[model samples]
Every structure is written in structure tokens, then in C-alpha cells.
Target: MLFKREFKRNLRSLIIWSIIIAGIILLYLSIFPSMAKEQANMDNLMNAVPSGMQKAFGMDRLSLGTLLGFYGIEIHLMTTLLGSIFAALLASGIVAKEQNEKTAEFLLALPISRQTIIAQKGAAVAANVALFNLVIVAASLIGFQFSSAQTLSYKAFFLLELAVFMMHLTFAAVAFLFSAVARRTRSIVSMSLGLVFIMYFLSVVAGISDKLSWLKYVSPFKYADAAQILTEQSFRPLYAVVMAVVIIGCFFAAYGYYRNKDIVV
Candidate 1:
């Protein structure tokens, strides 16, 4: 019952975000052929851009001439950042919104345990995230069908999507932890956005500065970097492990804290 309610409540926002992200992806892909035609000019334009800028944008190892490269350098940023923002927003508000709306007392009076509540909310989040990825992946494949670039590499594309999904899960876990401990829905929303943007900034800076390259380890964005994924066509085992650890740690911590948190009527 709780899972159904949560999922239904979040369904509208999920659809809106899916459309926005997929639309942007399709729009950018439509421009690929035009850019491909100007390949020489595009290369010249890229050459003129600073190396630091290229690296910051994940364009250092990719080209605008090829479809996959274009998708890697162009669409990957939008998909990851926007999809993560959606995940974070959804997870961050699922719990705290009850208190913000003065419904927490009502919810607490129910027969369900806090553990059950968290589990239901987490399941809703998981379902929503999975659905969002499915929509985006379907949209991407459709876009590829119309592109002039050679046949799409399904293995590499799916691997990239998997990384993207993992990134979304990581951000959602962090936001879920925030929702568990924080009462103000407004604050949780702000923190969720701030966390994602800050981590993204760290990733860009890490790419630009050798001295701070270690910062990549701290940013979730680095775990699924488009350049690295496209080049290697595989996720680094270490990154996967780190993300898994963070996801598990955050969920466990959220459960432990919320189970004992004092609720005000």
C-alpha cells in the first residue's frame, strides 16, 4: 500500500523528467549529421578550444565526426546530470515531504514500522529510477536509428547506460540518506541539487588539474565518466566497487538513523 502510494505520487514528475532528458538527447543527436558534414571545420574548432576545456567536458578523447563520439561528448553530460537530478529530487523528498506537509504524525500513527516505511519508499525510488532509464535508453536507440553514423555498438551503448544507471543510484542513495535525517523538505531539495552539482564540479576540476586528480575518487560523476567509458568500453572495477560501497553505506545509515529519530506531532 505504501509503495503504491509513493510510486503514484512520484509518477508525474518521473514522466516530466524523462521527456525533458530524452528530448534533449534526441535534439542533440539530430544535429550530429550536420556537425559530421562539417567535420574538418569542427575539428579545427575543437583544436582551437583549450585542452583544459576539452578535458573538462569529456571531449579530449572523442571527436564530433563520429556518432558514438558525438553521443559520448555531447549527450552524455545531459543524460547523467539531469537524470541524477531527477533521482536525487525524487528520493530526497519521499520521506521528508510528509513532515513538511504536517502528515508525519498521521503516518507515524499507522501500524507500519519506520523500517517498513523506508523499505517501501526505497522500492518506489528503485522502480522510478529503473523506469526512467528504460525511457531514456529507448529514446537513445530510436535516435541512433535515424542517425547517419554507422550501426550503433549495442554492447558499448548498454555498458554506458549501465554506468549511467549506477550513477543515478549513487545520487539517489545519498539523497535518501539526507531525507532520512532531515525534516525540512526545502532544505533536502537544496542539498540534493547542491551535492550533485558540487560533485560534478569536482569531476571537471579533477580532469583539468593533475594535482587534484585524486578528487575524481570523491566525485560520483567520475565513476562513469563518458570519455573513459567510451574509450575503454568498460567500467573500472574500482569505480563500481566504490559506488556499491557508498550506496550500501548510505542506505544502511539512513535506516539506522530514521529508525530512532524523534518524530514531532
Candidate 2:
């Protein structure tokens, strides 16, 4: 019942986010043909771009001529950015909103346990994230069908999608922890978004200079690198393990904190 309630409560948000992600995928992918037509000129233009900027944007690692390359270079970052925001928004509000709205007391008076509440809300957030990514994947495949570029390796593309989903999961878990422990919900979304952008910038900066490359270790974006996935055609098991640890650790922390938190309402 709790799971169903949470899922239903977030159904509208799920639909809206799915549309936004799918639309972005379609819009960006529609331009691939035009870009591919002027591939030589585009390559030359990219070549003239500063090395730091190229690395920061991953332009240095991908060829613009191929569909998969173009998607990796142009669309992957945007997907990850938007997906992270969506995950954060969902997670930051799920539990904190009840407290902020003074309804947590009413809910707490019921027979339900805090752990069950967290588990149900976590399931809802996970389901929404999964749906959002599934929609994007479908939209991307449809967009690819419309383009004249050569076929992409399904394995590489699926791996990239998995990486993106894992990145979203990481952000969601962090945001969930914040929501569980926060005294007030007013700044949860802002804080989560800020952290995400900070991590993203760290990854970009690390890419621009070898001296700062160590920063990538702290950035979830680095673990989901589309360029590496495209080039290697494989996911990094070590990074996957790290991401899983972070997710599980944050969730457990949230559960522990929330279980002992006092409800003021």
C-alpha cells in the first residue's frame, strides 16, 4: 500500500520528466543528419577549438561523422545532466516534503515504520528513474532510425544507457539521504542540484588538465563517461562496484538517520 501510494503520488512527475527527456533526445538527434553532411567542416571547426575546451566537452574523444560518435559527443552529457537533475528532484522531495508540509506527524502516528516508508519511497524513485531512462533509450533509438548515419553497436549503446542510469541512481541516493536527514526541506533541491553541478564541473575540469585529473575520482560523471564507453565498448566493473557501494551506503545512512529523527509536526 505504501509503495502504491508513493508511486501514484509521483505518477504525474514521472510522465512529465519522461516527456522532457524524450523530447530533448529527439530534438538533439534530429540535427545529426545536418551535422553529418558537413562532417569535414565540422571536424575542422572542432580541430580549431582549444584543446582544453575539446577535452572539457569530450569533443576530443569522439568523431562527429558517425551516429554513435555524435551521440556520445553531443547528446550524452546533456542526457546525464538532465537525468541527474530529475533524479535529484524526485529524491529530495519524496520524504522531506512530508516533514516540510507538517504531515509527517500524521503519517508517523500510523502503524507504518520509518524503514518501510523509506523503502517504499526509494522504490518509487527507482521506478521513476528507470522509466525516465527507458523512455530516453526508446527515443534515442527512434531518432537513430531517422538519421542516415551507420548503425551503432547495440552493446555500446546499452552500456552507455546503463552508465547513465547508474549515475542518476547515485545522485538520487545522495539526495534521498539529504531528504531523510534534513531539518527543513526548503533547500533540499537546491543543495542536491548544486552538488550535482559541482561534481560535473569537477569532471570537466579534470578532463581539461592532467594536474587536476585526480578530481575525476570524486565525480560520479567521470564514472559514466560516454567517451570511454564508446571507445572501449565496455563498462568498468570497478566503477560499477563503487557506484553500488555509494548507493547502498547512502540509503542505509538515510534509513538510520530517519529512523531516529523526531517529527515536530
lDDT scores in order: 0.89, 0.89
In the range 1-265, model 1's lDDT, one tens digit per residue, is 8999899999899989989988998898877877888989988998899998888777789888888888988898889999999999999999899988888888888899999988888889989999999988998888886674466567888888888998999999999999999999899999999999999999999989989999999998888888888778888889989888988898889888989999776
Candidate 1: where are CA atoms >4 Å away? none
- What TM-score quantifies how close candidate 2 is to the native fold? 0.96
Model 1 TM-score?
0.96
Instruction: List pairs with backbone clashes in candidate 2.
Output: none
For model 2, what is the error of residue 192's alpha carbon versus the real structure, in angstroms, after optimal superposition? 0.6
Candidate 1 colliding pairs, count: 0
Query: How far out, in Å, is residue 60 in model 1?
Result: 1.8
